[model samples]
Target: MKYQGSCHCGQVAYEVDGQLDGAMACNCSICQRKGSLMWFVPRDQLTLLTPESQMATYTFNKHVIQHHFCPTCGIHPFGEGSDPKGNRMAAVNVRCLEGIDLEAVPVKHFDGRAL
Candidate 1:
């Protein structure tokens, strides 16, 4: 299932392939505050309209997840890195997905806010 997504201002756009494995609800303070449901994908599956210069990266606390957002708009479209060591993986925000049936998707809760 390929889906296209864009930032709030439409400055950042991307397309993702494969069915969303599942939605992740992380309990971490940032995740809780952000309230973003996420799914996993390989970095190769995503195509960015802008180069790295067009995005801003944010990191906090454990500094494992590299949160990338559009510089023009603060909307977080997706994130890269799930492991502390920074291997290959991506955490895609479900909210950014288009034409998705959120209710039918499987969801998992992670104690992230607590981590």
Candidate 2:
């Protein structure tokens, strides 16, 4: 399914083609703090609808994930990272997606904090 999302201040926007049934709640420090439920999709499945300058990238720890956010509102609508096999992917924040039923999607718990 196709979905549209944006940062809280509307400075950053994107369109993604994916499903919500597989959304996840990761226990990583950043994930826990942000409280964003994520869904992974191929990089090609997501398109940024906003100007590149409107978004800022942040990376920490191993510096693998490129965490993108709106500098204006500090809202992280999505992030980009590679899987173990080196395939690029997008980790979309399901909460940012439009018209999604939060209750209908099953949230998987990932022990990212333990990694």
Candidate 3:
């Protein structure tokens, strides 16, 4: 399935193809404060609808993931990183997606703080 998402002010927009089986709620410092529910998908499955220059990137800890957000709205819509085997992945924030049934998607809690 394809999903459309954007930042709060619509400065950052994108289309992602995937079946959202569930989302992950991470307890890391940033994840905990941002309150994002992430749905992982292959990086190739995601297409940017807005200009990349409109967004900003942030990374911390091991600096493996590049968290992209809209500078105007300060909303994190997605992130990019590689899996253990080095396959590129995108972490889409389900909360930023349009017309999604948040209740229907199960969430698994991740102990990111312990990583």
Candidate 4:
């Protein structure tokens, strides 16, 4: 499935092809505060509509994961890595998705902060 998402300020927009069922909700500190649901994909599957310079990245603790957000709006749109093989992925904020019912999408929970 192809999904389109953008930042709250509409500065950053992107289209990605993947199944929503592939999404996961993590119980880590940042994820808990942001309440982000992730849709992980291979590096080849992700396409950024905006320029790389348009996004801002933040990482703390282990720093294996690259958390990308819109610098203009301060919304963490997606994330990548932390797993082996260096697979590029999108840990999108399900709340950022438009029109779909987030609660209807079944999700597996991960204890990210713990592991």
lDDT against the true structure, per candidate, is: 0.81, 0.93, 0.96, 0.77
- Clash pairs (backbone) in predicted model 3: none
TM-score of each: 0.86, 0.96, 0.98, 0.86
Candidate 2 residue-wise lDDT, 1-115, digit = tens: 8999999989999999876667999989899999999999989999999898999999999999999999999999999999889999999999998898888889899999899
| Worst 10-residue lDDT window, candidate 4 | 82-91
Please give the RMSD of candidate 3 to the true structure: 0.6
For residue 105, give model 3's deviation from the true position in Å. Answer: 0.5
| Candidate 2: C-alpha RMSD after superposition | 0.8
Encode model 3's per-residue lDDT on 1-115: one tens digit a residue. 9999999999999999989999999999999999999999999999999989999999998899999999888999999999999999999999999999999999999999998
Q: Candidate 2 has what TM-score?
A: 0.96
Judged by lDDT relative to the true structure, which candidate is superior, 3 or 4? Answer: 3
Q: Residue by residue across 1-115, what tens digits does model 4's lDDT show?
A: 7777878986777776777774688888888888788777665566777888998999989787888899999988777774475555556666666666876888888998887
- How well does model 2 score by local distance difference test? 0.93
Q: Write the per-residue lDDT of candidate 1 for residues 7-102, one digit (tens) a residue.
A: 788777888887776889898877788788888887788888767677788999867678888889788888988454555777888888878888
lDDT of 3 at 22: 100
In TM-score terms, candidate 1 sits at 0.86
Model 4, stretches more than 4 Å misplaced? none
For candidate 2, which ten residues in a row score worst on lDDT?
17-26
